[model samples]
Target: MISTRLASLLFCSLVLLACSSKPNQDYDTGYDFSQLHTFSGITTASNSDPLSAQRIADAIQSSLLTQGFKQADDTAQFKVNYTFNITDKPKKSGLSIGLGTGNWGSSGGVGIGTSVGVPIGNDSAKLQTIQIDMIDIKTQQLIWRGSDNFSFDTGGEDKAQLTQQTVAKILAQFPPQESLK
Candidate 1:
């Protein structure tokens, strides 16, 4: 019985973790990304989850380094920045718990218990819109921009993995492929 309850909870958690990766990209076609090497972070994000934003920046830096880019303390060849907003969404689900009890009194009594959660004001989920930008150090203007809109249970499992995957997805559109243009 406990196993069944645990399984149900796991399934619900997985359902809540579904992320829709809606990505939108804009960049300066005139600027050549191949000429850029060093990368530094400059952020103006004031979201509730500053740590998530920091994780995102770290993931981005890691991804760029893997692609042969260098990290600079200052005066980088290019700069990276990001902003995020978490919007409260309407509740799509309710919590449920079940309890059962029986008394051995000549087949006398049985009891059942259940609980359901009701959404209060501003007690729904959160949807985050994240935007990542790249700027030329010399030009000091926007050179590339990538944004993604995704939703997941902020308190659920695998948060670090989620952030890493989200950042990786956003950066996959960066450096703007010639075929994409």
Candidate 2:
């Protein structure tokens, strides 16, 4: 009987896991530039997750290279940098209700409460924003900038996959207008 119960529980767990949805890919990659050449190295502002920062930077660099931008040496046609910020908010799990009368009739009552499972205070880690900027190396003026704000669950393997996908999607917006069909 115990084994049967355990098997049932395991089946339910796997079903729930399978039913869970993957993170939605939401990003905006709007740029005004028509054409561009080799891109220089990328720089990142101080980030809580240095590994994440590097991963993002590398992903963008690789995407740029695939787009025909040669990694430059002495000078770059454009320079890039990114900033990431994370925020947390408390989450509530259940609801609360008051029940009248205790066993002693001492005017005391039993209060039942349950959490809503929704963030109530700064409790859940959320990726607030990911901002990337590109500048004209010669003029040192801002050429392109993109910022995306989205919520994500952290410290999971899915987070890393999402990051890579987000970076790639964002960089895909570079060089702006696409070739006419």
Candidate 3:
């Protein structure tokens, strides 16, 4: 019973340790513009899974259009592309200890206490980052971009919902609205 409790605790600790840290946003402030117009022929950085890339790109484009941007197929103002990079890091397990106390009595009477030691196990997981970039078609300089990090889970029916959430987050910085003075 003690060993089973220890194993459960260890498993929970390792699961918490595998979560990835958040990524920071790096944007260029010099190119601040009130309105952004889309460019023709929006392209994607080569991805291992073209179908997945298309799904993500389509979602992103839809979000941008809803935000009042026009999509161009010819010469346009801005070009969009997305890239993803995955990395794995090692994680160490967590250890915990418990203590118990007991008492002894004379006249052949005695009391006992219990203690437990939890030994956690080490594990590894990949940290996936999706970077969406918007570039000025004329100058070829990156005007705006957002990178987000997520821990990948293979089996989930919420992928489409999650993708929509990610798209909304990334485009929240777009249009570059200025503060009222």
Ranking by TM-score: 1, 3, 2
Q: Which stretches of candidate 3 lie over 4 Å from their true place?
A: 1-23, 88-126, 178-181
Model 2 stretches with alpha carbons more than 4 Å out: 1-35, 89-123, 178-181
For 13-132, candidate 1 gives per-residue lDDT tens digits of 665575334578998888777777788765655756877777777778887888788888585888888888777777855656544434465543434466777766556676777788
Local distance difference test, candidate 3:
0.64
Least accurate 10 contiguous residues by lDDT in model 3: 101-110
lDDT of 2 by residue, 52-148 (tens): 7877787778878888888884657778888877676444455543222233444433334444445554566566456778887777877676665
- The list of candidate 1 runs beyond 4 A from truth reads 1-20, 91-123, 179-181
lDDT of 2 at 59: 71
Return model 1's CA RMSD, one decimal: 9.4
The predicted structure with the larger lDDT, 1 or 2, is 1
